[model samples]
Target: MFRFEDNKCYRMPAHFGGFDCPGPEAALYYKDAVSVTFTYTTDEKQLASYVPEGFELLRPELNISYSQFREIDWMAGGAYNLVQVSVPARFNGKRDQLEGQFILVVWENKTWPILGGREETGIPKIYADIEDLHTIQPNYYTSASYEGNTFLRLELLGAKPVNGQLLSEMQASAATINALGWRYIPKVGAPGADLSQPILYPQGAEVHSAWAGSGTVKWTQLSWEQNPGQWHIIKALAELPMLEMAPVIMAKGVIILKPNNGRVLE
Candidate 1:
């Protein structure tokens, strides 16, 4: 149900791991990430808050439960904590002319501050480009509940699947009983919903579940634990007949637009 009508692009979450954010012009996917929740602006306003009004900022709806998010599934492995917001060029009205300086930057992972980093702040700094980002009309949303508070958005535009009809009856019951089609594992979050975020499965992992829809969901878990599952899906005819297995890709999108699946964003 979370389909804001292909507002265009900006699905990045795996910690801005892609879409190139090091420097030299990057950033080209932002289909209205909930308007970035209003680019951070609440300190005296009783801890900042906004429903609509922004350049970007919005990361606070977290409830938390699921074993306290399995103890740190918060995501953003590389690391990014820069706070140098300087936009006094007459924002909103657009003055001073540094391209009208309409700034708003934020990339929070507050490391599980409950749903940590709502829309992942603003994220436009690796030298800024993509037209300087600053727009939002429609994007997508619809996770009122998926068995476990649920809140996966590190990049999931035009996403589709609330329960996907009980996951198409669990992929037709694994294509009529095991022809195969269901291999995603190690994922648990059902209390108030903040499973430390970042558990979007499908990459080549081991453990987790809620509904891979008989689409062959497996991942038992061993090392890095939670989040970052497995997906090489080479050939399995979508998982069934002759079952080869190894080329799967229903892991949802936005990990900065595709950082080769097992990507830490990129």
Candidate 2:
């Protein structure tokens, strides 16, 4: 007979074995993280349709980011890359009201982080082959693809270092780093879910340098033949109308991922 224990972490093949749960102080450290991010206003109604219930769209803005991560602690100094799509939203839960960037979709180059992130912290992570950052002095570029078919590309042009006072002001005006996601696990041979809820995953960053630049994002409409499982996702995002574009930012920083500290929203 098998019995589940309390205060323990489990994943697939749980009946076979178990591992030590990391403490609250545990963090996955990221070194030499370079990220290119840009935000743009889109159609309010269309964006709202994608957001789950109990969430209020803070604005019409949508953000797209591509990052290169190296020297990871949990992977024993391994490296990977990722791309993210998110929107500003406020969750109106029964016991709490919180504001954060609600992740629409995230694609990672490796499988380890994807599985752990989705199962434990509720990040909507998927797989993509993200290329290393391509730089030509003042310009930086990267792309994401599935099965050798490129689906998205990101670039920052004319990037220049931010001055002391401006960087301070930008940091001061930044909002809290509370990331939101929806966790859903379907029951085997059933139409309903075994578990479904919203999650609050908090994280922090220690920035070493920052740059302001003209950022550009290009999303390719994927076909079933190109990306069978994720064609729709790419198509939908590619259809989002870009109403207004904001300045693109390139930042170098150390990212702190707190998987143990993540919690379910009430």
Local distance difference test values of all predictions, in order = 0.22, 0.87
Pairs that collide, model 2:
none
Give per-residue CA lDDT, model 1, range 69-91, as digits (tens). 11121242332221212222211
Which regions of candidate 2 deviate over 4 angstroms? 1-7, 172-176
Give each model a TM-score: 0.16, 0.95
Q: What lDDT tens digits, residue by residue, belong to model 2 across residues 203-239? A: 8677778999887888888889999999999998999
lDDT of 2 at 241: 96
Give stretches of model 1 more than 4 Å off: 1-44, 49-91, 95-251, 257-266
